[model samples]
Target chain A: MRRALKVIVLGVWLLITLFPLYWIIVTSLKPKAEIFTLPIKYWPGNVTFEHYADLFSFADFGAYLLNSLLVSLVAAAGVTVIGVLGGYTLARFSFPGRGALMLAFLVTQMLPLFIALGPLYLLMSDLDLLNRLAGLMLVYVAMLVPFSTIIMRGFYERVPVALEEAAQVDGASRIVAMVRVVIPVMLPGIAATFIFAFVQCWNELFLAITFIDSEDAKTIPVAMNSFITQYDIDWGSMAAATVVSVLPTLVLFAAIRRYIVEGLTAGAVKG
Target chain B: MRPAFTLRKARFIALCLLPGVVFVVLFTYYPMIRGMVIAFQRYNLFDITSTPFVGLENFRAVLAEDRFWTALRNTGTWVAVSLFFQFFLGFGLALLLRRHFRGRGLYQAWVFFPWAMSGFLIGLLWRWMFNGQFGVINDLLLRTGIIDQRIGFLATPGWAMTSVIVANVWYGVTFFAIMIMAALQSVPKELYEAADVDGASKLRQFWHVTLPHIRPTLALIVLLRIIWILNFPDLIYSMTGGGPAGSTDIITTFLIQQVIGGDYGRGGAVGLLILGLLLAFSVFYMNATRFEKAR
Candidate 1:
């Protein structure tokens, strides 16, 4: 009887959760007439790629996808480099400003990014970086790096001091020890941090929309929003836009799912 | 502090930590320091430096505005409502997932799907779904005999704020679920087994054992979630753009339109207000939690 209640409750939650997802998929496949029907249709009446086609022809959907891909990948790679190295240092070494710096990172990590939004915009404007992909990258890096570093710090903290000392005990250079010994154990953690950074950059909205206005640099979400701003939205097309926007997020989440799982575990439980 | 022997080790570590430190200092710390300074001046859009320092002018202006109170009320309401649903639903779902169930993996992946969906995209999706004339929600309700007429979910005052909260809850639930699930999983299986052997039912076990075990994690997750959601401008920005009557306007959204829309001084004041609330809440929560434990 106890087990039965668990099963029932679990089943109902699944229905509530997946129903919107199913709706998204169905709306993507449905014709316009069936999308906003008299009764809300659970199943698509007739499947069509017409909306997807419309998105491609009218908007820069491909460019947005490419931009999102490039940014997510590059930003993840950059953050991992900083996170792993900085995190390793914070974990292993006893330095003067170490505690203060860690506290600083924590402060930056949790503050609302919008608090800096106004001033950062003005600064970016001064530097002639507004509407540039590079500017967006800078903001993303600033926002995401602290998190990645924090994540890396946790992973590094879990490693013992003896290992690195032993590596140096064998007359290995500091850099060499990092590359050869320390990193091998920390690779899974590093990979997890990378996945976390990658997904965040991919899905970031507020600053991206604020900063990147030009078609040349638009990410997937902004371009997707263009479809939504229309008076008579082609529901099928908007659905396609959602599909396109979600593709990289899905792929990154799937490919790095194991690492992603680990990162989230760290962030929630141990963090 | 063995200086001579570990000097090189110290320098190497400092070098490693420097690059990241410089960035945080420049971007996060610098902006905060600058925001405090900006709060003093009547920071005009067309000429920033040219604008004279009007001591406490911005603060006074912000306080005097009726909209500031509305924003405070809206933001406070948003945070409370969002946190309430997010924690409860998330914890509930995590509890459900703890059971031995078929397709749990698939269920989790699907459940986590919204978290991956862009905040901007979710905003747009909800906006479309809630559209009055052709929206799926209104159509569904009328067809189901729930309401006689199409309700303007976004346009009306009472409904607008509630609508934004509902959409926020939808996106927020995934976040809390993932956090709570990780915490729940880390509870040693042996503990549960021992509890079962001792004849403690699930409810008792959850209250006595599980709650205390995961308390710290629960606190941290809630703290982090509140900070993040409170500052988030994009989700609200894209959803209703602070809505039909400014009823749904929050601190972040208010700051954005005011500051980013070129009301630098007033917006900066609003930003400071938000910063104060977050700081106050965090300190208060930590104190209360610690005080409760001490008692």
Candidate 2:
């Protein structure tokens, strides 16, 4: 009896968790006439690809997708590379001001980026960077570098220092030792850090909406927000766009699910 | 080591670290300092050429608005209520998922999926779900014979905050479950076995063994979540835009409106106040936790 009750509870929670995602997917595929039926159709009677087609043809969603992809990818790569170098420095050496730098990074993680919005906007406009993709990419890189560097530092600390020492003993310089020996072993960590940063940049909406007003420079989240604010929200197209927007993050997260708990808790748990 | 070799190593370290430091300082710290300065100036977007020092005029203007106090009260309710539900429900979830079961890995991934979604998108999803005319929620309620007629969840002031809190609870439970589960796993198996040998009931064992073991983590995560919930305005922004007479407006959303409305000085003042609020809470939290540890 206890076992049965446990199973039933789990099953009910599972349904509650997945029902919204399932509903959105179903809504996206349903015919327009069938969506707002009196007694909401639990299943779409006639599935249609019309909404997905409309996203491409009428909505100009392709540009937003490309923009999101470019910014997320470039920023993820930039943050990961910088994180590796910075992580390595913090892990391997104890230099002047290192402690203060590390504390500053931790403090930055706790700060709400909304606090910087007003001045950031003014500064970006002064630099002629508003409504530009490159500008958005720079902000993302800065925002992510601190957390990614901390995760990377945790990863670097796990690898024994003796391996690099052995390489240096074999007539390899410190730089070469890092490039050839340490980096090869840290590939998985690097990938996890990159995916974490990528998802953050991909899902960012506030800064994107603040800086990029031009339709051409808008990212996926910005496009979706604009769609929501329209006079008559096309529910079908909105659902379709949401599905497309969420696919990349969901896939990337699944790939790195194992590292997520560790990566997220490393700073807080240790402190 | 030789002086030349030490010098070369120091240069290499600096080379590795410079880019990260420069980017952080230029983007994060610089804007924050400038934002603080802007709070004291008459920094209007309409007349940016002459932004003179105003000596707390911006602060006075922001404080004079009744909307600011409403937002502050709503922020307290939003954070406290959301945190209460999220912690208990998530703790239950963590307990339920602790025991081994078939397909557990897959189940965990599926349940934790909401944490991977954007807050703005989650807001949009809940907004549509709560729609009175064609919403799934009303449909479910009617079919279940719970309500006689449809009710607008977002269009009404009273229901809007409740609706958003429900969505937040749905989204945030996964995070607590994940973090708490990790903390639970760190408790050694031997400790549980010893508790069982001592004739402890499940409830007693939980109180004595599990609670004590994870208290620090629980305290820290709760504090972190409090700060995060207060700062998070994306869901409220996209869901109701603090609608139905600004009933659901939180401090962060209020600040966003100030910025979007072209009053950077007021926005900057709001931003500084948020910073001050968070810093004050953090200091209080740290001291309380330290006192607990000492006891």
Candidate 3:
């Protein structure tokens, strides 16, 4: 009885958890009429790729995808570089205002992005960066770098100082030691930080919508919202667009999920 | 006592730190100060030439509006109900996942996928699911004989808030589950073993051994989750745009609406209110939990 109950509960939770994902994918593949049919079809009768083709062909979906890619890639890379340096310094060094710097990062993490929205818009406009991918990149980097630095700090904290000291004793320069020994050791943590930063940039919506206005510069989320706000939505194509938007993050997530979980636990549990 | 700071070390640290500091100050700190200043001015995005200082007029105007109170109440409901359900269901799910089982890794991945997606996209996905005319949810309920007629989950004011809360709960469950599960794993086995040897029941063992071990994690997660849920408006914004007469409108959405409508002064006023609320909450939470003392 106990064993059966466990199995049943787990199965129910699984169905509930996975159903939305399943439903969206199915909706994307279904014919338009079938999507709105009463007593909705649990499974698509005729699997079709018409919506996917339409998204790529008639819509500005290709530009949106490219824009998302360019913005997220540059922002994620910049955050990782900054995060690694700042994280390492905080983890391994003692300097004037180190405590203040750490507190500042924490404060930034807790701040509501809405607080910055109105002024940031004005600032971006003043700089003539409105509707530009570069402006969005700057905002994303600021939003993500603080959290990434904290995650990177956790990674560096786990590494013992002895390793770096041993390298220095062997006559290696500090920079050379970090590159040869510390970097290799911290590769998994760096990978985890990179994936986390990349996914955040890929998934951000509010700022993207606010900052990017032109059709050519819009990211997937904003473009998807445009489809939503319209009077008549092509449901199938919209669902397909949703799938395309989430696919990259989902792939990156699956590949390094274990590391991501570990990174999170390390950051929080230790505190 | 501190380690001696050498010249080369300071130089290296400065080099590493300069870029990140500059970016943060320009984008984060500068905008924060500017947002505060904008709150005191009669600023309108549509009219850039007349942003003169207006003292407390904007704050008074925002606070006087009935919509502000409605949004405040809705925000409280949204955060409280969502957090309550997310905490319990998430903890339960974590316990279930803790037991080793077949295909558990895949199950974990599937369950946590929602947390990986954008909140706005999640909102859109749930909006489609709760569609008044063609939603899968209504279809399932009808097919199962739960309701004789279709229900407008998002169109009805009473249900709109519930619908968005449901979506928020679903999106947040994985966060609590992941954190609690990690804490659960790190609980030493010896405590359970000792309890069993001492003639304690399973419930007692759990109460004594498990709860205490995860309390800190629980406290921290709860604090962070509250702040996150309060600041989050994307899911609700995309789902209903706080529609059906603003029943689902939260403070964040209200502020966003003001900004979108080109009223910068009112939006900045609400923004400052949110910041003040968050600051107060953080101070209270730190005192209640004694988190700072622990640190």
Candidate 4:
């Protein structure tokens, strides 16, 4: 009896947690007329792919997708590469201001992103970078690099220093030694950091909205904002867009959910 | 170690660190300093040529506004109420999930999915659900005879803050659950056994054994989350645009509004105010927890 109750409670909680996502999927499939009907349809009566079809024909969603892909990929990859090098340095070597550097990285994590908003806008505009993908990429790299560095450092701390020393004793240079010894061992950490950075860049809206105004440069999040205005809400198209936009993140997250959790734990509690 | 060798090692390390450091300084620190400078100027977007030092005029003006005070009060409510419910519900859910069960992995994945979702998207989802005319919430409530009329969850000042907080709590619970569950699982099973030997009840065991072990993680996460919650305006922004009557407006969204209005000076002032609050909170938190000394 007790076991049954536990299962039922957890099942109810799961339903509550997933109801919004389920609703979006259901709403996306419903015919347009059923959407705003007084009695909300629990399930779609006439299922159709018309909304998804409309998104492609009428919107520049393709461009937004490409921009999002380009920005997220570049920013994530840049952050990971920089993070790995910096993480290794912090982990392996004792240097001047090392303590301060570590503290600064932590402080960066706590600092509100908007602290740099106005100035960065001015700077980007002055350099003719406003409404540019490259501008967004630069800002994202700065925002994410600190967190990625800390995660990378946590993983590096777990690897024994002896392995790197052994590689060096075999006449390998420091950089080469890290490449041969540390990279393979830290691949999981690297992947985790990449996904974390990628998801962050993908989900970012405030910065993207602020920086990119052109149709060619808009990302998925910013592009979706057009559906929502004071007058009208294109519910069907919006739902379709949401599902499309969140699909990559959901898939990537499910694939490496454990790593994401572990990375967060390390970054949050252990760091 | 020889002096030459130590120097070379330092140089190599510095070389490795240089790119990351330069990026951070140029992008993060540089912009922050610039933002501070902009707080004292009339940096309008359209008429940048006439920009001149304004000497605390922006600060005074922003502070003098009625919306600023409303946003401040709403921010306090948003953070405090959201944190209260998230902590309890999250802790409860974590405890429930801690026990090994069938399909726990699947349950865990779905339960944690909301945290992976973007705040704006979550806001959109909730907005649809809470739509007064055709909302799932009202449909369910009406069907169940809970209410005769639909509540405008996002349309009224009284309910808008609650509505947004509900969404925030849903999105944030998974974070607390994930962290707390990890902390819980790490507590040695032997502590429970000892508590059992002491003739403690299940609740007592939780209070005396589980609570003490997880206190540090709990405290730290709460501190960090307070800062995060304050900075997080995305969900609130999308839902009501801080809505019906500026009822749901928080400082972050208020600052964003100023920028969107082409009032960079005022926006920068609000940003500085937020920065100051966060810095003060961090110092107080660290001292209260003796976080630095513990290290």
Candidate 5:
């Protein structure tokens, strides 16, 4: 009986969590008239991809998708590449102000993305980079580096220095030792950092909305805004768009979900 | 092969590290320092540096502005309310999920999904859910006979704040649950078994065993989230556009207005003020946590 009750409770919560997601998928497939039917049909009797087709045909969604892909991909690659090198240095070398430098990096990460909003905007304007994809890439990369570096630094700090030294003593170069030894061992951290950077870039909103205005340059979140104006909501198409938008992230989550969960827990508790 | 991975003598490490340092300095610290100067300069609405400095002028105007106070108050309220619920609900939900169960992985993903969503999207989603006329909430509430009329949740001041809080709590709870659940799972099971053998109740066991074990995790969450909650902007911007009567204005939104209003100096002043408060909170939270640990 207790076991039955536990399952029931879990079932209820799961339904609550999954319904909105389910609602979007079902609503997306349903025709407009059926969407608002009195009983609110939980399933679509007529499943069609009209809304999805409309989403791609009537909208610049393809551009937004490419932009989102480019910005996030660039940010992920940039943050990881930079983070790996800097993180390695911080982890291995004991330079003066090392602790202070690490603390400063944490402080930078702590600062709200908008803390420098005014100046960053002015600087962007001055450089004539107001809506440039390259500019957005620059901001995303800078914003993500500290978090990535911190994670990478922790992973690098853990590798047995003796192993690296032994290899070096055998006449292997430092670069080779790091490449062959430190990096392979740190793959999990590297993977986690990449996902972390990509998610952050993808999820960024305030700056994205504020900076980018052109149809060709818009990302998914910004592109989706036209569906829900203050007056009326295009629920069906909006739901369809939302699902399409969420699909990639869902795929991303499934891929790195394990790394993300473990790293997040370790990051908060250990750091 | 011999010198490809050469030692400390090689300049490769410095070369490798240079690009990242340049990136951070140019994008992060440069803007930070430059923003400080903007707080002083008149910031030629058209020409930037051509404008003359007007020391303390921008600060005075910002302090005198009524909307600035509104933004600050709402920001404080927002930070306090979000931090409170995020901890309680997150902890509560984490405890609920701690027990081993079927489809645990699926449930975990469902709860964790919102945190991964862009704030812009979450803002848009909640806006639909809270729509005054055709919203899912109004439909449900009306069907249940809870109210005769729609609540106008994001329009009225009292409800507007509540609306943002509810949305924030929805997303915030998952963050806490994910973090806390991990730490909770790491806890040894023997302690619970030992407590059961000692005839201790679940509540007592939770208070004495689970609470202490996860205090560090809780403290860390609280410290970090205080800053994050304070900084979050889309929660304000999308929901109400800082709404009905500037009722939901927060510092970040206020800064946006300053930028749009062409008052970069005043906006920069607000920026600096916000940065100061953020720093204070960080130090305060860290010290307090340290004090609690020491005692």
Candidate 6:
């Protein structure tokens, strides 16, 4: 009886958790007429891809998708590179003010980015970066670098220092030892940090909406937000766009799920 | 033995750290400081020709508004109610998911998938799902003989808050489940075996063994989630736009409105207030965590 109850409980929670996702996918595939029937169709009666076609044809969704992809990619790569250097320095080297620097990174993680939104807008406007993809990338890199650095630092600490010493003993210079020896071992960590940063940048909406006003520069979230704000929200197309927008993050997340769980645990609880 | 610190080493260290430091200072700190400065000025986005310092005027204006207080009150409800449900339900979930089972990995992945999603998109999904006329929720309720009529979940003020909180609870439970599960795993099997040897019942073992083990993590995560939930306006923004007379408007959403309305001064004021609130909580949280560590 207890075992049966436990299974039922888990099953119910699972349904609650996944129903929205299932509903959206099903709703996206449903024909326009079938979407708003008297009794809501549990499943789509007639599947159609017209909404997906409409997403690209009628709306600026193609541009939004490209912009989201480009910005998230560049920013993720930029933050990961910066995170590698910073994380390595913090991990391997001890210098004056290093403690303060680490503390600063931690404090930045605690801060709400919304507190900086207004001035960030003004600063971007002054730099003529408003409505620009590069500008958005810069903001994302800055926003993401702190957590990425911490995650990388955790990864570095796990690898014994003796490896680097062994490399140096083998006539390898410090830089060469790091590049050839340490980095190879940290590839999984690097990929995890990169994907984590990528997902964050892709999912970002507030800064994207605030900074990117032009249709050409708008990201996926901003485009989807605009879609909903229209007088007559095209539920079919919105659902379709949402599915497309979510796919990259879902795929990337599935790839790095284990690393993310570990990273988050370390970064949040221990850090 | 490691080499002594040298000029070349210092140079290399500086080289390694400079890019990140510069980026952070240029983007995060610079804007944050500028935002604080803007709070004291007459910085309207419409007319930026002259933004002279006006000490505490923006703060004063924001404080005087009835909407700000309403948002503040709503923020309390939003965070508390959401956190309450999220913690308990998530704790239950973590307990249930602790055991090894067939397809556990896939089940975990499927359940935690919502956490990977964008807040805005989640809001949009929930908004449509809660729609009055054609919403699945209402349809399900009606078909199941729960409600006789279609009810606008987002249209009514009380229901609007409930609706948003429900979405938040759904989205956030996974996080607590994941964190708590991680914390649970860290408790050694030996400890549980010892408790079992002591003839502790399942409930008592949970109280004596599990509770103490994960309390520190629980406290920290709860604090973090409070700040995050307060900062999270994306869900509420896309869901109701803090609609039906600002019923669901948290302080962050309130700040977003100030920015969207082209009142940078007021927005900055709101931002400072949020910063102050979080900082205060963070100080207390840090001290509490330190106490936990010491114990």
TM-score of chain B of each: 0.93, 0.96, 0.95, 0.93, 0.91, 0.95
Tens digits of lDDT, candidate 2, B1-295? 2124377778988898888888889888999888889899999988889999999999999999999999999999999999999999889889889988999899998997886788898888888899889889999999999998999999998899999999999998888888999999999999999999999999999999999889998999998888888878999988898987999999999999998888989988999998899999989999998888778
Candidate 6 runs further than 4 Å off:
A266-271, B285-295
**TM-score of chain A for the candidates in order shown:** 0.91, 0.96, 0.95, 0.95, 0.92, 0.95
Error of 1 at B275 (Å): 1.0
Report the candidate with higher DockQ, 3 versus 6. 6
**Tens-digit lDDT track of model 2 for A29-113:** 9989988788899899999999999999998899999999999999999999999999998998877788999988887777777
Per-residue alpha-carbon lDDT of model 1 for A42-71, expressed as tens digits?
Answer: 677778877788777887677788888888
Error of 1 at A203 (Å): 1.7
Q: Score residue A20 of candidate 5 by CA lDDT.
A: 57
Q: Rank the candidates by DockQ, best first.
A: 6, 4, 3, 2, 1, 5
The per-model DockQ list reads 0.47, 0.58, 0.59, 0.59, 0.42, 0.63
Q: Which ten contiguous residues of candidate 2 chain B have the minimum total lDDT?
A: B1-10
lDDT of 3 by residue, A36-119 (tens): 787689899999999999998998889888998999889989988998888888888988899999888778777677877888
> Per-residue lDDT for A19-62 in model 5, tens only?
55666688789988887665556578899888888888888778
Question: What is the CA-based DockQ of model 3?
Answer: 0.59
TM-score for all models, in order of appearance: 0.91, 0.97, 0.96, 0.96, 0.90, 0.97
Cα lDDT tens digits for candidate 1, B1-295: 2235376777788778776777667666777667667777778776765867788889898889888788888988998998899889988888777765678777777777776776677777787778887677787788789999999998898898888888888887877877788788889989989999999998999998898888888887887787777776667777788878788888778887776667677766777777788889999999887776665
Candidates 5 and 6, the one with greater TM-score: 6
For model 5, the TM-score of its B chain against the native B chain is 0.91
Model 3 lDDT at residue A148: 76
What does candidate 3 score in Cα RMSD to the true structure? 2.4
Model 5 in CAPRI terms: which quality? Answer: acceptable
lDDT of 6 by residue, B191-237 (tens): 88999999999999988898898888788888878877887898999
Write candidate 6's Cα lDDT for A63-125 as tens digits: 888899999999999999998888998998888999999898888776677778889998999
**Residue B5 miss distance in model 2 (angstroms):** 10
CA RMSD of all predictions: 2.9, 2.2, 2.4, 2.5, 3.6, 1.9
- Model 4, B7-99: lDDT tens digits are 778888888888888888888889888888899998888788898998999899999999999999999999999999899888978988998
Clashing residue pairs in candidate 1 (N, C-alpha, C atoms within 3 angstroms): none
Say which prediction, candidate 4 or candidate 5, comes out ahead on DockQ.
Answer: 4
* Per-residue error (Å), model 4, residue A52: 0.5
